[model samples]
Target: MPKSNTIPVVLTIAGSDSGGGAGIQADIKAISATGSYAASVITAITSQNTLGVLDILPIPLAHIESQLDAVFQDLNIVAVKIGMLADADIINLVADKLEQYQPKHIVLDTVMVATSGDLLLKETAIGSLKDRLLPLASIITPNLPEAAALTGLAEPKDAEQIEHMVTAMRQLSTSAVLLKGGHLEASDESDDLLITQNETHRLSTERIRTPNTHGTGCTLSSTIASFLAQGEDMLSAVSHAKQYITQAIGHADLLKVGQGRGPVDHFFMLHQ
Candidate 1:
């Protein structure tokens, strides 16, 4: 076990992306990049690369429980980032753990499908994610497809339609909803909608044209958790995460990792 210290600790519960661009690998990289210690509890293993996902194997629920128990018992985990829970059972187990540990910051990247058009979560678990896990998160970061899945909004064509989607998601839980517009068909800027219980914020950044946006959602959510673990408020955390991911996407072309869509440069700032 690593020695306990005052350094902020962030925990991630997600799948393992063998490609190392997303899931637990991306979470660790993003958290560490934010100067926070990262611990992980993997819920599934995925055989994937920039091209596509080949297969997915969900971890046993008991093993997932054990990992969560070990971390919460030892580490003062300040924030948790959850991603790619494979089934309803896995989602329930994760929710139970969060209930037990009650970490201060919880960021849920509602990862439904990969950038390569592969489904990450089972169809049967969608209801469970909305009914059980959505309520527990401090915030949920969902791209257009994920938001549509949760809210039954299909494709939100205009700003008013997008607002309707956001309202539907906010109705699910008191937790804040971060509806990401990255998946939308936009020509200029990608805007993100952050809707809290009492406030609504629209954040926009100039879109960096890159094919290396494979794990952008995972990176953003984990980075938000990292900032929250560092004692920043939710609004500040989201803002900083957006800035960090913009820089990462800007540097994506520098790293020649895979044949198809590559990964964002998580440590680009370090190389500067």
Candidate 2:
């Protein structure tokens, strides 16, 4: 029997977190909570909890290829959210599949580091991600440090420096860049700059203070993908995603999941 296409399907290509706070787990939860069916291809598996990552096991390249083929062949995927790529080989392979399959909206969350201060991607993979995957993405969501790493500049210390960093990032091949400013601890307001080829839009939301902020990047990017899968424009998708993540973070304090950082309430509305 043919599958129904009434509901939009969003694909997440990332790692797996045993703790279910980030990566494939978070992506699935966010996508489903945002009103879309979620599909996934895990690039790596991490023995991770809210505290930190203990070990990482790479999915064999052939198995990764098989997984990509299986999904692209069968699923009616409208959008893709790409997260952590452990090395250059995996990056190249994902780039190849993306180019071959050509999903309509590809949101790349440059997942280089985890909230636990653990490294998720290797330094050697940066060049491959830049040369290969960046060009294929519809938009990239990068936090300050990831943006700095991509552009070879220090992390932006202020709004002016942020603009400068975005200017440098403009040379990259992606259609747009969402430079997340949540890392600026001094700010009461969180401002993320959306840089398109035509114009730049500033997305600002109140910074909610909470100890539970794990999976924020994954959740935000997946939510954006869900919106895009549902036919929202670039700016609208990003705007809605920002609003959603803020609420999720604001409600995060209500849930006590882990000893360290905790996951956001992907289904926060249900609790309301």
Candidate 3:
């Protein structure tokens, strides 16, 4: 039997990237890189490369539930990172599991769109996410496009607008919202706005000029969950994760894994 205070375990509930750039692969890599024991429950499988997603095969809800039950029953999961929900049913299933296990920390990556501008989650699933999952999340990370979609905004142009959208999302969900500014058009820097019930924090970093930006959002959320599993507080975890991702992007390996875009090197720390 495992000891009471073994290595912190973190679970990732998301899709599978066949190319291993994003989704469950990226989540697992990020969790392991941050010194956490990684577990996963796959929601879907995609035949994809850095170029684009060609096909998506969603797993049955029963299988996802079984995977979740198996892990939570055996291991002591400290944190959870939720990504793509293939459909409304899957989203509901995940929500049920969260209510049952009640992990100490939960990071919700609102994975609606892909880096290649592909829609990952179904439109009908949004209602379920907003109603069931987001409320239970400790934090919800949404990129610009996804935030706009959730808030029904034409486009979020400035930081003020971003905060407004986040506030709107907060009204719909009980979790703190982190609105990512990477997708916004900017000449100088990238700004990510994190809004909670009590305060707002603005994190700014230089825009990384690279095409190897795949799996960034997934990496960020999972990294934050890993830090949380290590007993870091919420704001501290987010701040550390921001710095981690910034360094990861700056030192991104220039490997042409696929024809179009490529993944960042999660093992950059090992090489450094």
**Cα deviation in Å at residue 95, candidate 3?**
0.7
- Model 3 / residue 128 / CA error / Å: 0.6
Give the top-scoring candidate (lDDT): 2
Ranking 2 against 3 by TM-score, winner:
2
Tens digits of per-residue lDDT, candidate 2, 67-176, equal 99999999999999999889999999999999899999999999999999999999999999989989989999999999999998999998889988877878888999
lDDT over C-alpha atoms for residue 15 of model 1: 96
| Per-residue accuracy of model 3 over 1-272 as CA lDDT, tens digit each | 96675799999999999999999999999999888999999999999889889999999888999999999999999999999988899998999989998998999999998899888998888888888987899999988888777777766887677766766766756668888899765636888878887788888888888888899999999999999999998889899889888887776755557877788788788877
What are the candidates' C-alpha RMSDs?
2.3, 2.1, 2.3
- For 1-272, candidate 1 gives per-residue lDDT tens digits of 98977889999999999999999999999999988999999999999999999999999989999999999999999999999998999999999889988998889999899999899988889999988888888999998888888877687866677887766876877489888888665547888989986778999998777789989999999999999999898889999999999999899999999999999999998778
lDDT of 2: 0.94
- Runs off by more than 4 Å, candidate 3: 1-5
**lDDT scores in order:** 0.90, 0.94, 0.87
TM-score of 2: 0.97
Better of 1 and 3 by TM-score: 1
